[model samples]
Target: METGIYLIVTIVNKGWGDTVLEASMKAGAEGGTILLGRGVGIHEKQTILGISIEPEKEVVLSVTYPDKKDAILQEIVRAAELKKPGAGIAFVVPIAQVAGVVHLFHQGSQSNSEETK
Candidate 1:
């Protein structure tokens, strides 16, 4: 596997942004970016009746060491209560390249591992 970090973004129902951020941070993430969005799914009924449903959402993005991805994801899931339906979704995307933070990543990894051990 190529050695690099990952950025995890959790898109959840509105008002959960702070929870996600706190969870990630508690799991060894420094901080993250938050964005507002609108989610659309099954807006109308199949029958003749016309009904619409839209969900307001918040997207929380965080970057962390590849080794810490799993912990961070779990924290977010629990904090956001993602197990329940209509809560939200979480996913990770690989970061092929980065700059100016290699040292920070190494230091954080060391600190976290030491604490765990």
Candidate 2:
């Protein structure tokens, strides 16, 4: 089955997960999941008082339909300033199948039914 679902994966500096989430929602995404992580990019290497510190990161996962994928990604980029070095990165992966998101499909179908009624 072709679900036409895409997963928008966004990785940004720690504490910016909420910004991504809100942007995704504003672009029509239902919701998203945020996970804590740590990594250092070439532009992110730094030292604090002679001590090196690994940068903390937030990984945001937003599942959305094809129609909203581009808009959601653009919003995330604008909100997170991803164009800046070391700011963050966002990408999309097409999902062949998914589970536990029946509510989203159900709501879409309900609206379609109402429109036809």
Among these predictions, the greatest lDDT belongs to 2
- Superposed by TM-score, candidate 1 places the C-alpha of residue 36 at a distance from the truth, in angstroms, of 0.3
- Give lDDT tens digits, candidate 2, residues 1-117: 456578999999998999999999999999999999999988999998999999999999999888899999999999999999999999999977666676556545564334333
- In candidate 2, how many Å is residue 69 off? 0.4
Candidate 2 residue 97 Cα shift, in angstroms, is 1.5
Q: Give all TM-scores, in the order shown.
A: 0.74, 0.84
Lowest lDDT block of 10, candidate 1:
40-49
Instruction: Report lDDT (Cα) of residue 44, candidate 2.
Output: 90
Write candidate 1's Cα lDDT for 22-102 as tens digits.
Answer: 999999998899999976534312333565546678999998777889999999999898888667889999976565555
